[model samples]
Target chain A: MDVLKINGKEKEFTAGQFPATLAELLEQLGVEAATVVAEVDGDIVERENFARTRLAPGGSIELVRFVPGG
Target chain B: MASIDEKLRRAVVGVAGLGGLGSNVAAALARAGVGRLIIADFDMVEAANLNRQQYFLDQVGRPKVECTVENLRRINPAVLVEAHNERLTAANVPELFAAADVVAECFDRAQEKQMIVETVLARMSPKPIVSVSGLAGYGKSNAITTRRISPRLILIGDGQSGIDTEPILTAARVGIAASHQANAIIELLVDEIKASAP
Candidate 1:
């Protein structure tokens, strides 16, 4: 099993098996309902594949959530 | 002061929803010479919109975005225009704002306005948003004020004023509110106000 450091949290999961959608990863991370936006390396991941997308080892991710006000 | 030509050349503005406020906002921006604009609205003109919208009776049945682009083009043929004939939602907001130097939230629905603001703020989109609220019924011009919710967010309209109660139709009130919005945007483009300026 390997871990992906997301934003700052390190999540450990079995290596080699990954979801086909990025949305699935969000659900696994308990962040599907968090108004989360995914940015892989410096570009944003389109919503079309968020649910079926997966992550690879050493691929950095940034999950942005909206804050109330402004 | 930056010349009108210089001010327009560097601006990439987005106006969402073309109604009383949005229509006036778009027209004012065009008249002020904004270099580039992205206008989005899925609505079509209704007979009821004859009051404040800068549209004629002949424009009825045309898409708001299309009509806005047409009207703006006629006003300033040299300005660049991109019209999106779609609703503004969370899904398309990012792409809509990706190249925008500034954004205006003209949605009459408070919920929609909140959604757009939250998304822009969350993404740290780097452009300022000029938002509207409380311009429903107008009696006193002094009631309107532009408040800075953050360094990058400016809110127009009167505090605690609801659109439903005010019954917006006349061009006067909507025009005032739109002017405030356009003024804030011009100030934003020319660096007249610091990000810290309220």
Candidate 2:
């Protein structure tokens, strides 16, 4: 199982069983796409490629939500 | 006295997004005569943004960076506006923020925020990055707080508020967060409270 940490919460997903795309990961986690952005290992994943991308073990992922103000 | 204006004239701020927060931040900076602004954002205004955003109905479909630039220039013609219509990334972060006296992290995503914070911290620049968090759906306005994470990093927004499966966000919360960000920037520019400590 691979650990997916968002903000500070950790979740487990079977290796190679998780969605390949960022969007898929968001959907699986029940995250709002409009309010959040994905970062894999400290790099922002473009919205267009979030769905086609795959995750690797020990790789930390963060899903950040956009706040209304600074 | 003259030196203050001169310093302000030479100051450049890098704003990494142009959403509601970024747009308002940039606008406030321009109005304050910050001299130079490097605005970067890759989003376009949707019809849905008219609710509380500073865009008009006619501006829908325009790139956010473009719209913001137009607005900023109109507000202060003497201020320099360098608009970048691309997303800020690791490869470009250095170049984007190289000359900034202060960097405003107006991004909406958490991953990007952490990446940016780490990137700036790992670098040699003394420029401080002020970041925002937790302004979703909006009732916990009083929960919002500001912390100077480091001499060079400040995080604005409520420590307790978040996307709590409720309709919490409204124009009020957004304004509060943005104001905090602006004040942080102004403080960084004028006050060396931590840096100048004897």
Candidate 3:
């Protein structure tokens, strides 16, 4: 089993359940691609590359969401 | 051989939108004697913007970038201004801010804010960006504060007050948030000076 860290929280993912790509990771997390920015393992993953960027098992992720305001 | 004040005068700051936050930040930086300002905004000065933005009523209907340039000149004629009367997108943000020492994120909507932040953080790493969030209503002036999200990103505002829920933007509150952002930018510039000092 591998542990994935998202915004500092840890979640366990077996080899089969682990997301293969950043896009799948975001989808499983219920985060919309439009409203958030993703940084995986200290490197920012561009929105266009989400579907192509592979997620490293046991890696850390930082997802920032923007709320409506000035 | 330049003093900190002289360095401030020679620094170029990019303001990515000319709404309440951008307008005020530009004005403040100009008054602080920051030498060059690069401003971009696709909007015109509407009467509604007068409440919180640093634009005049008579300037309404004029492009915000044009008004900001004209007004910044009045605030400090020695300041050099580069005005862009266009919207900023991920494709253009990098080139537009390439020459800036620090970039300010002052857009109104969530998507626009996210775009600038993402573009700057991903594409313009190490340039430093000061962004605002959740300054929407009145009072609780103390709630608006600055936080360093990372070494390159500084966020200013009460983390929870949003325009979507509050729907009220006042001069005092918005100005406070804008000032917080501007001050944060100045502090970063000063920190650079400190880092390079002998």
Candidate 4:
């Protein structure tokens, strides 16, 4: 099994069947690319390069969205 | 030999907004005896801003920057405050915050917060930026925590909470986050001074 930690939660998937890139992972998670910022394994994934940024087993991802009202 | 309070008095902090977070943060810094403050905001004190923002009823219709400077002076008459009654933009950030030892990003909008953070990070380099996000509605106070995003960026407030159906901003929650931002600025200033000390 391949496991990824997202926002401090562990998510499991079938080995070799996990999303190949950050973009695919975001789509799988139902996250809109424009609304949030992504960080994979402590590296900021620029909006333009999200599709090209590869994902790996045991990787950690943090997605943050800005909140309104100060 | 300058005392700690004197050191704080000599520190100049740039507060980028005079809203709830910025107003409270600036007041906290002023009360703590921070030497100088550079505050900016183009908005005026509206009745709508009274719920969570730091302003009296009589303050409505006055420019936020002016009110903030006046209030800060009242808190600590010796504190030097420079008020800019203009909206912060990427083009003016460098000059506006040139003397700031730390910049507090307190815009209510996400895009504006991002703009100031990116601008300060790119232009200010080593100067720390303390910002707030996801602090809205009446949520648990513990949810407001500070995270050191990078060596130069520290973010306060729960990263997931925001205004939704409630459409409310409570003084309790916003105050917690504002205090967190203020404390982070103080910590960063102390650390910087300690690092540079012989």
- Model 4 chain B: weakest 10-residue lDDT segment is B189-198
For candidate 1, what is the total of clashing residue pairs? 11
Task: Give a tens-digit lDDT track for model 2, residues B121-145.
Answer: 5563566788888665556667667
The numbered model that scores best in lDDT is 3
- What docking tier does model 2 reach? incorrect
DockQ ranking of the models: 3, 4, 2, 1
lDDT of 3 by residue, B1-198 (tens): 667687788788999998988999999999998888999999999998999999899999999998898899889999999888898999999998898889999988878887888899888867888888778999999998898766777888886687888969998998999999989888887667333322
Query: What are the DockQ scores of the candidates, in order?
Result: 0.03, 0.12, 0.58, 0.43
- The true-versus-predicted C-alpha distance at residue B76 of model 1, in Å, is 0.5
Residues A32-55, model 1: lDDT tens digits:
333444566545565454765666
TM-score of candidate 4 on Cα atoms, chains taken together: 0.82
Determine the TM-score of chain B of model 1. Answer: 0.91
lDDT of 4 by residue, B103-172 (tens): 9989887767767776776567667788887788785888889998766778888876766534688888
Evaluated against the true structure, the overall lDDT of model 1 is: 0.71
Q: Which residue ranges in model 4 land beyond 4 Å of their true spot? A: A1-28, A32-62, B193-198
Cα lDDT of model 3 by residue, A1-70, tens digit: 9888887899998769899998998898887787677788877777888899888767988777666666
The regions of model 3 sitting more than 4 angstroms off are A9-20, B193-198
TM-score of each: 0.70, 0.69, 0.87, 0.82
